[model samples]
Target chain A: MGVKRFIAVLPQCQALGMRVESADHEHVLFSLPFAECHIGNSRKQLIHGGVIATLLDTACGSVAVCALPRFEMCPTLDLRIDHLRPAVAGKALYCRASIVQVTPRIVFTEGVVYQEKGRPVSRAVANFMRLGAGKTPVEMDEALFSPNNEGEE
Target chain B: MTYSDSMAQLVSETQRSGHWETLLEQIPYAGFIGLTAQTLGDEILFCMEPLESNTGNPLLPALHGGVIAGFMETAATLNLMVSLNVDQVPKVIDFTIDYLRSGKMKPTYATCILSRQGQRIANVQVNAWQKDRETPIATARVNFLMHDK
Candidate 1:
């Protein structure tokens, strides 16, 4: 449940082409690049709605981990996504998730995905149930991300 | 136009052409996850074959949570695509998914209902199940911006 450890265990994210763009103590950003392999409908050249849903789920889950008082894998209780627009093909989409609330048993978070700056394409909210036994809270910064300097990568 | 009229027209077109099956086959992610489409009279059925590649929790042997979400979302989109008989993919306006249960290592089935349509937007609901039609593992609501033909 240490904030950063949760992001490290996501093999599914790698399979779907999502990478972390930024992360701090309370907020995390994820980016999903467009690829032919991930396109939902080829004729229309749209990124699959399912891919966006995956991104929203992971981003929201990351927020839950960040909000956790200790390191425990929070199970997703529920998730909701609203597609604001069709994700245009050939552009990488971005998402940023933040913790909305944290109760002892559950965590609430919201996230938004977009291609262009300031224009959101989709948004989602999720709830994660905290586990009873948690690992000791550790320094999550070093283990959280791949080596990419904030402005450089 | 009445809902019945449009529904009848879609059934006729898809029955003759198998448009939904073809579209599901063409999508890359759909193919990646082994998604298949079957038309049952007025309903479109989406199926996912169990595979090691699609597994997220090896310990539980459950399908990845994302895969289930993706499958249901694709089912909802394809439902609208075939029903409206539209040329372009309907742009999703929003989607809400409720994961009622974990999808285990077995074939999963889904169906979608085109709940409402306005001039520019449409709403769809999807139900996914593993064992019984009466019980669903997940439910989703997807809103789309219908394209101008």
Candidate 2:
């Protein structure tokens, strides 16, 4: 519901110039524009692997915020990122993250990144330690988490 | 410029600057991140200078998780490049990071251990701490594929 809440909350995310394409109770999408600083190898013209991970982490965190019943402290407990292929340069990449499971103390989510009409460039699964938001159980919205709910923006 | 061009430029800077910190500026992304490096005896230290552009949460005043990961990964890569005595960039194959604590708004430091080194791949374990080394803010293990110059 609060689409603007993310840009308003995390300035670093804003600084990364990540765009929130869509955010609703159903799904969350984030896109990061290519920048000179994002290039890992000026020769291969590849996007830095860490930058991809950062974008994916932010995307997952964004969904966690958009989907959580209330704003809470959710810090990454663990993050595993796999690069299927080098992220080609000169194209924006997108990530769609859905909360797979949420418990009183933890949140699990996974996402994939790719360019327009391109095969997945990378994939990631992350776990966040839920914090601060009191122990109220979060209601599970089945449709919001369905794997079919994914795509651009 | 190609990787070899950048590699040559970095090689000369190390020869002329007589300081490994020059690597921070030679790499475009490293310069953007504002990372600083120092050598104290046998230990190599990497620090992320606090700049407003790198803050993740202005509320907790914490360093962005991505920045922390980037910094740690950068540290590992650079250290591997130096330890292996290679001139080519190490491409990251995968990275696994654990956030032990919120990285507060301050200078954060990291040190890397080149755990396993081979002709084609290397593994580095990194520990990043904000205030106290005993209490690290985050830890990461990275595997990189080494390329020949």
Candidate 3:
């Protein structure tokens, strides 16, 4: 499956309404619109720190997917995130992630999250273990990328 | 009452009554992801019931990596709030997580250890597991800035 389709088919991404803004082998950018369910502090309406982590993880993981020669299931090994500031309420969040390094065994990625162009709210660095296409489950491959699958849009 | 004052009151009531569920209700995101807390003595065990929407790899039927991180972060935040008995929500300064294994589609559980609590900052370490506590699926360290009232 393509990077965009892989992300689109992810149930968690669908539930969070994550949108792919742009993606390529070098980097991938994603955006998440504001939702009441994403608020951690109801009184202040601040976006949950966990929500920021989720966005970063998704962006970083997607970029890792792009870096691979063929789509492989790379599970995250470790992740580090720095919350520069609390995300503003009711504003869509954007994250841009790119590969920092890739080895035979692991892929390292770094990403930044922001609501606006320049003002970053958080940063993240993560590494994923490279499980080759051989590890890809047959059912998942067919369910995600099957050309004959219904609703090919 | 002011928001902070009410929050402080709520925290105190929660601690006194040993009812963390009421506190979890205040966090909309926690509820959205199906997070619940159970108190065991002075410790709290956080659980995320298996939900189809939280799945990332349907073949493995595993929980999303992001969902696992979110659950651990939330667990750390609540643990800090209750441990310090603070009035305001703790702000995450930084978080580091290590995934030891894939989080399967099961009721995942997490426990937080308050590593250190300074006046303005607190450090928490969280371990999440499914099926067996001896083997953790993921572990995380979270640093939080305790906002002043």
Best by TM-score: 3
Winning candidate number (lDDT): 3
Q: Rank the candidates by TM-score, best first.
A: 3, 2, 1
Candidate 1 regions off by >4 Å? Answer: A1-8, A134-153, B1-14, B17-21
lDDT values, one for every candidate: 0.75, 0.76, 0.87
Error of 2 at B11 (Å): 4.2
Model 2 accuracy (lDDT, Cα): 0.76
For model 1, how does the per-residue alpha-carbon lDDT over B1-149 read when each residue is reduced to its tens digit? Answer: 65445544654566577665544555888987888888877888889988666766454556777788899888887788777766556677677778788788899999998889887999999999999877888888888888664
**Per-residue error (Å), model 1, residue B1:** 26
TM-score, prediction 3? 0.95
For each model, chain A TM-score?
A: 0.81, 0.81, 0.90
lDDT of 2 by residue, A1-153 (tens): 544454545776776678888876546888888888887666667787767878888888777666677666677888888777888778998888788887777888887888865598888888887775563223212223333533311
The TM-score of candidate 2 is 0.86
Cα deviation of B82, candidate 3, in Å: 0.9
Q: What value does the lDDT take at residue A26 in candidate 3?
A: 77
Worst 10 residues of 1 chain A by lDDT: A134-143
Best candidate (score: DockQ): 3
Instruction: Give per-residue CA lDDT, model 1, range A22-86, as digits (tens).
Output: 77657888888877777876655778877887788788877777665445656677788877777
